[model samples]
Target: MIALDIAIKNKYYANSTAVVLKDIQFSVKPGEFVAIIGPSGSGKTTLLNMLSGLEDATAQKLLGNSKSLHDCKEYQLGYVFQQPRLMPWLTVNENIQLVLPTAQERKIKTLLAQVGLADKGDYYPKQLSGGMQRRVAIARAFAVNPELILLDEPFNSLDAPTAAKLRLLLVNLCKSCGSTVVFVTHDLSEAIYLADRIIFMSNSPSSIIHQVNVNLPKPRKESGSTELAWQSQLMAQYPQILSGSVSTD
Candidate 1:
């Protein structure tokens, strides 16, 4: 269980204080997948940071398993950033292995297979396509077996088809592993496709404008009426979400 009662009293600027995120409150159950989406400059990444205990909340509680976030164990988190952020010099297998606890080569091979990179493990980051690099990044994150995973637009650079396939793989893996996912993305369709619930936020000085609980059945079909309907519903709220803001603390 992860909960964040987030409120930002004030924020820093070049010469003064400004507010970024305010009155942001949400609770995520174990094994639930929640996606946060907003325009650029919104507090999406900042929000993730607070939830992961990389930043402090001005006047709210951040809890992991009902305790303070900072007090929680570090191993509970598995983060995948927007960029692959992999070392160019490291082979795909080496990169994933670097984050894994074991020295077993089979573990690397297994993760590569899971991310659809089994044949590309020996290739370096520079040798892979953008989507492939991201796959390697995902493989690294999953290798940790974290209970709570945070993803920040990890598939943004991929084509729609590839992205959709990866999303399916990711959601299925999360379900099978019983991992709770807090993913940040700008893609509404992707959110509708993979999330159990979608949290829509306004631009900077952000807060939740709407929460659309995805009612689509599991193993979400890429092309189907149910998924399309939910996607349309979330998209309909985009304009309102972009134009509003909420006070934090």
Candidate 2:
């Protein structure tokens, strides 16, 4: 069975004649990591929001192994936003526990350790570095061992070294838990590194313009030869892919 089936017919702000998303449809397989890449302002975050149930998904015709985000009573979803969005007043450990009051301290401890923040649990968000805050956010998302995880540029704005470490950590955790992931990003190289398949979205009134499978070995190294070669090949084949200038036709 598919992990998710989404057919978003259209999205428009109230009383606005301009359209944001149109005829955007795709399906994610169980345990597959899919990345949706597009230029900024292409509604990638909006789509993630709809999937998370933070925004209404009435227009999102989601099905198969799941229902609309609001009525998806059986699907356990996790999300890591562009910002860590941690509760400033809450300690890192407490932020995780807040999401799952029933979660044991031991379980939370293990998660923090997995994200490489074992000792920082007692520290509040204000006391942690940006990267540290993100670690807590990720730990909180994984606390429930979600069936599907949605990540919105989770590594955005981090230093290259830090982002690379987190990417490896995120992928390793996803592999261990076997969670299907849908990550949205504007970075083609990042998409190539993390995704099993990458879907390119067109400019506004967006729809998927292209989809390419990455046959590279899993847990790829940053700027690895094979990874770089594959990326180069894709770029050569479709120079306009990243800029959202590729034709949806």
Q: Which digits, one per residue and each the tens of the lDDT, describe model 2 over residues 1-249?
A: 138888988887547878888898888999999999998999999888887877667746877476555674666778999999999889988899988849689999999999999898889999989998998899989997888899999999999999989999888898888898999999888888899999999889888899989999876878899999999888878888888866333
User: lDDT for each of the candidates?
Assistant: 0.77, 0.86
Cα lDDT tens digits, model 1, 73-95, are 65467789889999888898888
Residue 84 CA error for candidate 2 (Å)?
0.4
Candidate 2 Cα deviation (angstroms), residue 205: 1.2
Candidate 2 weakest ten by summed lDDT: 64-73
Model 1 poorest 10 in a row by lDDT: 240-249
Residue ranges of candidate 1 with Cα displaced over 4 Å: 1-16, 57-59, 233-239, 242-249
Candidate 1, pairs of clashing residues: 22-248, 23-248
